[model samples]
Target: MYVYLSKIVPLFLMPLGLIIFAAVLVLLLLVTGRRRLAAWLLSFTVLLLWLAAMPIVAGSLYGRLESRFPPEPLARIPVSSCIVVLGGAVGLPFAPRQDIELTEAVDRVYKAVQLYREGKANRVFVAAGNQPRSESGPSEAALIGELLVEWGVPADAIQLEGRSRNTRENAVNIKPMLEATGCDRSLLVTSAAHMQRALASFKEVGLYAYPVSTDVRAIRRTEYTAMDFLPDAHALAMTSDAIREWMGQKVYQWNGWN
Candidate 1:
């Protein structure tokens, strides 16, 4: 139920969705002869859109999330502990290619491999499942495992937990696997923005996962340029992601899943 709702709810909360909603409301008010209300709604919507596109606003929102957990150096991660890499790093393949395609969160997989090569962890676990509407193909975990093998990690050193569909499910499903392997502690690899919720979910399931955040989105700017204040679609997208993480944390807490 949570998984299904999560996938659906975000569509209505993001910037595009909010803009559409506001537009519809304004149309309704104008049709009802409430011109004053319509004008107010239009202005509010435009202001929101402008704010959402500002780089400074996007950076600050994303920074709050990505900074929740500082990146852990590979050398400092416990040696021989299991390294668990969460999903959201890969997209479903559109067509067969020579290699699997990775998304912005590819840092999760690469960091996991680096942990293994540095001898910080003897085993790497890729926790991801097939996309909900995806057609036949290996799951995300399997695809990442293949990449690990290509990167010189032993095939036997990698484990696949490809049944989880979200962070909560990832924790619930991976618990049994960890227990079976006597892995009481693990190095958790995921996007820096998602680490807070991921850590909370794992804790709820009784796993003490040491955070090794990846794919950090927040950046510190030493000087602001003219372009810094310009409206950017990418900034809006980043803001949406940060808002989603914030909401995820709140919802997880409310449901006692974290």
Candidate 2:
């Protein structure tokens, strides 16, 4: 119940949920003949949606998170005991689909492979999981491990921690494996915006990892064009994602997970 609650409870605080709630309230007010209250709520919801879909707003939210961990070249980072790649890259071939569809975060997997090939680490640790009621199949760690082997990484060098379903669980589940392998230090590969929470979670579990970020979405510009103020679907998605990340990190802090 707690695991499911962890996943579902945060939605109520996000833009979509709040908008929906406000809209429903507006309708209720109208049914109760409270026209003025309904009008105010309807107007507020529209304004909220407009701001959330603006590229300028999206850019600012993403920039704050992505800018925290700037990318470093392979040469600049010292070789670590192992490479830890967090999940959200790809999933197994479910029924009706024989091929895995990779996500934007698939760069995490590619970067891990590059680090291994470049001798940055001899071993790679993939930390991923499926939700409680996910389609029954291989865990994401197994899928990622297979990809690593297909991409030239030796099969024996890959370690899979597949039961973790969130950032906190990722750190907790991988703890014993790192201890058993004596991987006292690691290179953590994940999306740039996600690195802040990922790094903190790992540290909470006593793992010392250096950041290796990828999939940065923040636009680098001293100024924005007029188009940036226009509403866009992609901008809305970015804004939602940035808000989720912020909310997740705050929740993690409150729970002492990081």
Candidate 3:
């Protein structure tokens, strides 16, 4: 229940969700015959959305988290005993397409592959964080594992973990697998915005992880084009993700999972 609530409750706290919430409140005010107040609230909501969609605002919010663990060259990073890539990189095959649908965060997988090929570890734990029997189809781990093997990573080198749906769960579920790897140190790979929560949760589980973050965003915009001020759907989505990652860290800390 906590898992489901954690996913659902954050919606109302982010950009689009907050906009919808305010819209509903405005509607209620209109139904109560408070036309002037409803108009005022509607205007406020529109402005909020516009600000959220602006690249400057969105990038500023996410940049803090994404820059926390900036990308480093493979040679600079110490080779750990194991590499774990968190889920959220791909979608399962369904219906018309049998191919995996890679998301923007697919760098998570590519980075893991690079680490493996470079002899960083003997095993790569590919976590798609879904139940194996997800009605949507196979777990993302299977697709990623398949991709890794096809990309020349040996099948024996990939350990597919399909039972985690979030960072906290990833830390919890992978502890045993990490133990089996018989390595004193391990590298945790995920989007830069997620490294904070991922590292914290792993610490709570008694595992000290080496942070290897990818998919960085702007920590600061040095120059602004006109596009920076314009409203963008992608910017709005980035804002939503930033809001969630920050809030999720707080929630985890509150629950003693961080």
- Clash counts per candidate, in order, are 0, 0, 1
Per-candidate TM equals 0.95, 0.95, 0.94
What is the per-residue lDDT of model 3 for residues 151-247, given as tens digits with 9 covering 90 to 100? 8889988898887888888888888988877855888899999998898888899987899989776656578899999999999999999999989
Best by lDDT: 2
lDDT of each: 0.87, 0.91, 0.86
After superposition, the stretches of candidate 3 with alpha carbons farther than 4 Å from their true spots are 131-136
Rank the models by lDDT, top first: 2, 1, 3
The RMSD (Cα, Å) of candidate 2 is 1.4
Candidate 2: minimum summed lDDT over ten consecutive residues — where?
A: 130-139
Estimate, for each residue in 1-258, the C-alpha lDDT of model 1 and write its tens digit. Answer: 667788789879988799999999999999999999999999999999988988999999999888778787666777756999998887766666656788999988889888988888798888998757763777898888888898888999888999888899899999999999988889999998899899999998899998999898879888888787888999999988888888888888999988
How do the candidates rank by TM-score, highest first?
Answer: 2, 1, 3
Q: What digit string (tens of lDDT, one per residue) describes model 2 on residues 1-258?
A: 767987788788777888999999998999999999899999999999889999999999998999999788989988899999999899678778888878888999999999999999999999999887764878988899988999999999999999999999999999899999999999999999999999999999889999999888887888778989998989988988998899889989999988
RMSD of each: 1.5, 1.4, 1.8
Error of 1 at 178 (Å): 1.1
For model 3 the local lDDT of residue 187 reads: 84
